[model samples]
Target: MEGRQLQQVLNTQRLKSLQEWMQESSITLTQVNGQRKYGGPPPGWQGPVPGPGCEVFISQIPRDVYEDRLIPLFQSIGTIYEFRLMMNFSGQNRGFAYAKYGDPLTASTAVMTLHHYRLPEGGCLTVRKSTEKRQLRLGDLPTSINQLELLTVLRMLSDGVEEVLLKMAGPKGREVVALVNYSSHYAASMAKKVLAQAFKKHYGISITVKWTSFSKSKHVSETGQEDGTFTPPGLSPLPKPSITPPHLHPKPSLQDVPAHPPLQSFFRAVGSPAGLPRDEMKPQGPVNRDAVSLLQWMCEVNRLGTPRYEVRFHHASSDGFLCFSYEVLIPCFLIPLYGVIQILPGPSVQATKEEVYRAVAELVIQTICKVSNARPF
Candidate 1:
């Protein structure tokens, strides 16, 4: 048992069982948006919401280390108003977390004292003040949205809304964009995550919500960079929009039309024969194909060798959806297609990985259909 415990501590990638973790940690944690929380405002605590400098970001943490060890360690520096450990789906820490103190002074003390502090296991931690931006930029809003109406809707969707300013966007200034300020960084962060889906579901309109740079009221371009990223100079202009080829569209005869083409869910992994849960990351249609069966069919159809998948989780969208970049190497294709797939974030990373495989399989069928359709008789 001692050897097992020691190995668990040493294996940085090991995932701990929830039962084993609960026995070791006393703090009740709630998981959301890929972070594990322990008291954003701890129980029996009453004071103003923590502002800037009240939180410290800690990194280089060992994966096996959980809140039981971390919370107590930071608590030594000062009263911990909150401690959030970024968690992995497989029960390991994401190697970084944030700790909010009761005040700016205590948070500063944590960084001064604990930056580069050596752990008992001989690993060093990097601690610094958390950089939490408290503004969000909303685009694709109704052209007629007034400040009062948008504010009313925002308050209904999320808390900590301080102010809203509408801007005329697009070349003709027909589109409306809004900049929103929040009372606290946490509120802004949470709002950025939920607002996108909230508007779409409740109002049946798609809107983009992302962290904004208050450095300036807006970007030089009227539309501004999307997802909070700036486009550098000398980049090729975005490709002209082209109508999707008819063959690429979901055909009833193929028996493998993809679900959620925008999300690139491809075929969207459906349940297998064993009563497995269907992948409802998005609303999917009837399950006509699984990855394995689809891949086998693709191979037979193309007379190609085995297919290969090279994929990695690249980044998370501003609204908390996970994005993965993938390269599908097919023996028949001279150039393997590279693409990005966006998936709704969830606890199971492995399951998301499997979904990517299914997506690739469905994509292969689409590509072949397009090729076959284009060939001259």
Candidate 2:
């Protein structure tokens, strides 16, 4: 086969795989309305395409220079289709602008030819395509729908999302805006299509969607003190930004609790188990070694249909081995077990030899109680 034929075959296979994956996951990708055809699909099968002119998002420009001033600079290279200068509450320029050109080839050429070329001396121009194609400015979100519920709805529509920003957009008692983050441009594009239908029906709230820069929607307030210094909120006096680490940024996961401890520490804590009684030293109790095995099998079998039990797997070691354990004790409610409470009699090998056996015992007890309770899902 010719090289171009082989490439075409490969592209067709890739698109087929993507469509299959979407169908299995219950996502349907349809054509978008008002989608201008500036360029063909990304070197392959026919589908919704992005226009040739890249969305050039600019920032840090003087307010005095409005849309009229920018058009000539941009149109010099290509036919400018749309130009917008964003404004803030005070009717002042937000120091940002967006320009969409008519032709993708011309847009690409312009981006390559005119970047960072100082505009007649001291003036500077920073240009690049916008990362976010479009976003829904969700408002009046029902307070009943918390963060998790909203995220679940979005995940059902897209492949996977990076982050979801929820904030109060109105007065204290009502209204909020959620900035949904998708994994890629295609996923965002797909999400923008499906969200309006899903949201209105489920939440009774209609959101406004627009092609805007995500950076502009991200708001962070740095507080300053009476002493004339800036600080984090709740801190009396602020500190200098220069002293802060360049890599330091507010990440939501910083607040998340890790499920497992380091392997070395875990092993060091479970170094050895208590010596069995003299009679049981032979690795057999009235409940023989086989009984221990049978009891463990039952726990595993019962877990499959158990409603109350929350089962999770973890690794405390570098070796590809898992720690299979269940909690027994109910920390909040110290209710003793009434029925036949069965368990394997020995320390779990998953833990390090130096670990405390009693903690493992406690965990087993907690697991049973929690899993058995008729509680909220």
Query: Which has the greatest TM-score?
Result: 1
Candidate 2 scores a C-alpha RMSD against the true structure in Å of: 22.7
> lDDT tens digits, residues 57-172, model 2?
56555544444345557768866555555544333345566566555676666667666646542456666655433233455555544454454345433433434556654545
Clashing pairs in 1: none
| Residue 90 local lDDT, model 1 | 61
Q: How would you encode candidate 1's per-residue C-alpha lDDT over 29-109 as one tens digit per residue?
A: 888766888886676554534556698888888777777667878999988888878766566677888899989999999
lDDT (Cα atoms) of all candidates against the true structure: 0.60, 0.39
lDDT of 2: 0.39
Model 1 residue runs over 4 Å out of place are 1-25, 46-48, 170-174, 214-377
TM-score of each: 0.51, 0.28
TM-score, candidate 1, is 0.51
What are the C-alpha RMSDs, in order, of all predicted structures?
Answer: 22.7, 22.7
Model 1 lDDT, residue 297, Cα: 38
Task: Pick out the ten consecutive residues of candidate 1 with the lowest summed lDDT.
Answer: 240-249
